[model samples]
Target: MTAPAALAGFDEVEAYHDAWWDEIVAQAQAPAEVDIYDKDWRFLSTVDDAISGDFTDLYNDAGEGKLAQLAANPVAQWISENVTEAEDLHVRVTQSHTEWAGKAQTIEESMDSDGFESMNISFLHDLQHAKKIYCYPNPFFLLQVQWPKIYPYFGPSVTGVKTLLHLNLLRRYQPFWRLPADIFSKTAWAQDFEAANWPHIVNPRGTGLFNDTSMHCIIATRMGNFYDVVKAILEDAGLQLTATRWLPGDEQPFPEYATITMPTLIWDVVDKGGVRGKTGTLLDGFMPFVRSILGDNIQETKTPVPYEEPQEYSEDKWGTVKEVPAVVWYAAQRYTTATGTGQSGIVKWRKTQHKAIASAILTGGKSPGWVNTGVKLIANAILGYIGMIFLNPGLALGIFDEQIEDVILAFARADLTNLRDEMGRDAYGEYWESSGQNGFSPSTLAAFRTGQMAVQPYTSFQVEVVNGQPYWYGMHAVMGDRVSMELGMSGVLYTDQIRTARLTFGPNDPVGWTLAVGKDDDDTSPTARLARVLQAVSTIAQQIAVQS
Candidate 1:
């Protein structure tokens, strides 16, 4: 079915995306191996040959599927938007700063007093030193798409590099990968499934859960018209723009923001694992722990074919290949325990029904002593009995634009730069009454401007001032988007070293929130942090709404 006429461009964009995917795959070159260079962490570096030599392997290997799913993203579009935006922004800032500076001098000269000393200092500082920057939410998956639909790898990389983290996570946690596909895809594990009798086996499809980990930030934002841009962001959060009104006297819209609210959203889990109620006790914990160490393993009690049937050959980690019986298996029972003086072996399973991949380890001598039959059996039982309940974290349902009006009002209060200093502030000391862009090339330095839109504490540090006095002293540290400031009298440290806004999360900002979410991943921005905080605030409210 076609979307409504209102969504005209959306379909075309979707078609473009499909075609783009096909084209990129054809254009994609798979080398023997690609050495990944990570400046921050060497352990993150690896040689990805999964896409290196063979096309067939590329399709079969899991990593390529994940990368291919994410390739041809509109990163170029964002880069281009930012390039033009920087120039335009530089022009706007210089013009505003010049006009404000002129009016400031006249007001200050008329009233000079000691009490006004701090006010003068503050006023002068704002004009000559403090900066104003533009900010807006830039969440990944800005469209109404969910992560699982795009980032199928289940867990987004902490480093924001898909290929790097996917490979690293897989290599680092091979054991975790063995989890049932449904649980692994959700990046969750059932630590205690025995209580529920591992319900997933009876109904595998019911275990999947959704989590809304959407983080809105600047680095991840794409450039677009203001109206359409707001709508797109809202859609990503499953919201709608229900109102639009012009200013009292102006033709332009008043605030240019949308009011987003979820009147109702319900999720009732009546079966809240009253299943694990037995395991809740201190005594129960001991039994589970003992069972865990030795494994309350369940072994296959049935096989479709006899153990004597011709076997299949499988390779082991130690390079040896062995033949194991080929058969379909079903049904497992708890591990066999000692009947008398002692137990004969850890577990007793029908050889015909044993899984070949696992049997290979036992026969290939790769199984460690700790991995005795009983331990293996119990581990398998726990994994199969393990089941998890999930609640879709739903996309970024945060009212990110919630504080837009407040933020804008805060910026409006900032007076302009003064007349004399405005000239010095201008390039070549030529102050244009009607400001000129001149050499004000928009650069990354604007990222550090303190306040709401400020990126310093929210994302990274992008500015470098050399042998110059600090500006935050007289000015409020609030940069742009509502960022709380963390500058001391020492201000910014002047060093010759070129730094990206990679590591500077300002002073009192929620640095930990985005630490796992990296700047390159476009998930580490002030908007993302604020949105997360706001969304968390209403979890119970949302839950109640859901129940209603």
Candidate 2:
């Protein structure tokens, strides 16, 4: 989480005053000629500025931008640009939880358990890489904070603001989707994983800011028999693969799962629908799916009220006319409650409470004074102490978040039966049926689970190879000593290309980069504020002791 910001009702009061004054002045003055196209013309000019500006400084100030630059390094760029052209491509699959497979009937059963890359079993298809690469907590949020200069041009309208967001999304988030192909080669594939793989979803994007909603992935439509090779290897180990689906006639798949169950594909969708970067509109074709899920839009209008007569219009020429009303037109300003789940307005009440609590953090719920800062410091310290100690639930040690996700999915009656099919879980599910899963002996999961095995891609093919033979091997980063594997495949896949490629160039690993941003490791982050509070408290205590 984030610290609550101080509330400055001064802004609200100033806004109301400004609106009232402007309306009164307009009522007094003669109407002037205005060009209807002026706003449109200005908007077009602003868009041009956005396209032409060198926002590197602006980007440097944003956390997301820093991560994007990391992913766009030369090695990652090479993998992203070249892998698409390769005929065969392989994506490493990762387990959702550390110990989810522990409950399985056998090692083979655990190998086929549901994981993050099990989209072929969960959603039936995977998102396309190039077409859908939008990440959120909106990178623009940070950029706008750092560079307010651009906001004056783009903040006037919803379209303008969203346009700015879309541009930032494309520039800062595209690289997230185009991450290095073999970065996770050491990891194992989930059951039902096919030609497409979305590794970004697993690591770098794991930060709370990105979450599962980040539409970043790799779809292997380019050429190559890597899928066939992996299929043979997996089947030899008595593991079945479900075919992942693709859209018909080259239509791109849905970018995120939230988009799948959305009712309408409309413009108001804040973040859902269609290929992310491919569409030119703001948020691409995505809409505010969150609002829709909550309920119908609740637009409430307040009745207009008149400004006080003596104080507001006493000195005006029309003051004597009782008929003259100095009404503040905005007294009727509308406020919408987008969430109307009909829980007796509890949602709105909670939002209000949250907003007030956030405001009180910075202001200490008091007027400005010399002691304001001290009060805020004390308030934060007290709250922080309470939260970190008494209020906090015990740390979730050794518990994988994926286990919770599995429970939720299970309660929702999610079916995992489709994951056990012999072929990839696509329309062509039977294409590889002839290749039986009886070639290799069962219980071979130990090879992948018990050793210091390093995954090495074939010199010429997408499959991993060792001593001129296709082999399966991987190491657990946390428990490298526990499991090892060296499985067999039919072909002699070479390994020269991946071995020679520069895969180690980077400022920081993407996953680590995500975890580092806004983390306590930084002196300027929220943790620093707490440190300052502690120092202040210590100083005050020392002064009191000296006085005594």
Candidate 3:
């Protein structure tokens, strides 16, 4: 009554596949949250903590299990889906390879402008072109074989154009195809022709080349012997290249795609009901404003007064203690006051008591007494009177100045206080009240903002002088993952402050795109403006620091 040995393997595979499907479906249905941050407007310190604590927990509980199931199921389905008609799969594979070879020719032709000579071939081009060529007829079969095996069951259930687009995009980078090959085969290249036609054949066991998650893994596995392939291609084409390796076991096939939830803070700050129209509302916009002030000659100074011991008090017979009053005295010069008793002949018990006492003073003895102590007190009183006469308008102006400066510095220091106003005013007032119909509370908005800022891109300013004058320079302004902004002069300002100015972009040469500093040069693009502010702020900060 025992089951056949062959049936045992099939049973195990079926069970694994079923589990994988369950995992993928669970992942797709799981609830996700995204964190938003006002990188330009607020400084966030607690973001990393929140990500590790709250986000990580949520991901583990709600996402990981389901994704695992989905990724696992689809892999098992691949063998049954495409292996049934290996002939069709081979024809599709051949067409794909031919198309890829044609595209490789185009890539080589493009490289000619940059002095690039074709050398070793790129598997990415081959895969991408192949997918494009056989997109319509191949996706369903390919997905059955590739998706589950490569991404686990969580790979998107795409067919036709969508499938082609995904495959083509994935293959252009080499990171995508190499994942399956690395997990399934010992020699990825040995299986290239077979995989080019039937990717499932490359990794029938669903273990080796099929599981790689990182793009780098694909590159390494495909062209490990030729370290110079990527370098040569990118260099020859004059393209910047930044590459890194994937974590160990990361290349293994997973059941689902990692779902990144948007942080509540993004909605709170960015929603119409949120703090819209407020200064520094747009995280991207606020950066330049901050640089405008902090990048300049802004300095902070602190003067410390030595602590003096408090005079002790004496108690009466009732044990009620009373402190004696002390008076602060000031004098311009050392002058002794003498008390004499003029009585006809009675030497009024003349007791000469001379005690040394130093007066508390701000300045050395100089000028008139009125100018030393009296002037400061008089100035203060006059200023107070003037303030009253102006009905606190001047005071309001002063307060406004301080607050504005605070906003700028808060951004520069990336202080948490920046989020306070954003959460209270933007998220709570605008987003929740207007958009969410008051369903969201201020506390919730605050939490959301905190989460959002955690993931936003961090920017740093770099300054360089062009045309023998100073200008702002910055990088990685708006978004992460290779997005950046720069500012430069369009023309000479010809103003009292600056003799001349020009605008340009940073992380790029300023040869053809330079803008004159001050004149009405329409070439003063956003990048140039950003550069200007960055340079100005940097200059100001350096000057202030030096002066202090």
Local accuracy by lDDT, each model: 0.21, 0.22, 0.22
Each model's TM-score, in the order given?
0.13, 0.15, 0.17
Candidate 3 residue-wise lDDT at 178: 39
Residue-level error in angstroms, candidate 3, position 260: 37
Backbone N/Cα/C clashes per model = 36, 31, 83
Question: Against the true structure, whose TM-score is highest?
Answer: 3
Model 1 RMSD in Å is 34.4
State the weakest 10-residue window (summed lDDT) of model 1.
Answer: 56-65
Tens digits of per-residue lDDT, candidate 3, 1-548, equal: 98999999999999999999677544432322211112121211111111111100010001000011111223223322433322211100011001101111111112257564221111111122221222211222333353211111112111111222333333432333434423223354344323322221111221212221111111111111111212222211112211111122324222132211221100000011111223432332333223322421111122345533233311111111112111111111211223211211111111122211111101111122223244445545666678889886233333233222212111111122333333343322111111100112221222222222222222222211222111111110100111111222221111101112122111222211111211121233586468546744654454234222
Using lDDT as the measure, name the better of candidate 1 and candidate 2: 2
| Superior by TM-score: candidate 1 or candidate 2 | 2
**Model 3 TM-score on a 0 to 1 scale:** 0.17
Model 3 bad stretches (over 4 Å): 1-166, 169-185, 192-459, 463-548
Q: After superposition, how far is residue 454 of candidate 3 from its true place, in Å?
A: 10
Q: After superposition, how far is residue 33 of candidate 1 from its true place, in Å?
A: 40
lDDT string, candidate 1, 458-493, tens digits: 223222221001111102111111111112222221
Which candidate should be chosen as best, given lDDT against the real structure?
3
Ranking the candidates on TM-score from highest down gives 3, 2, 1
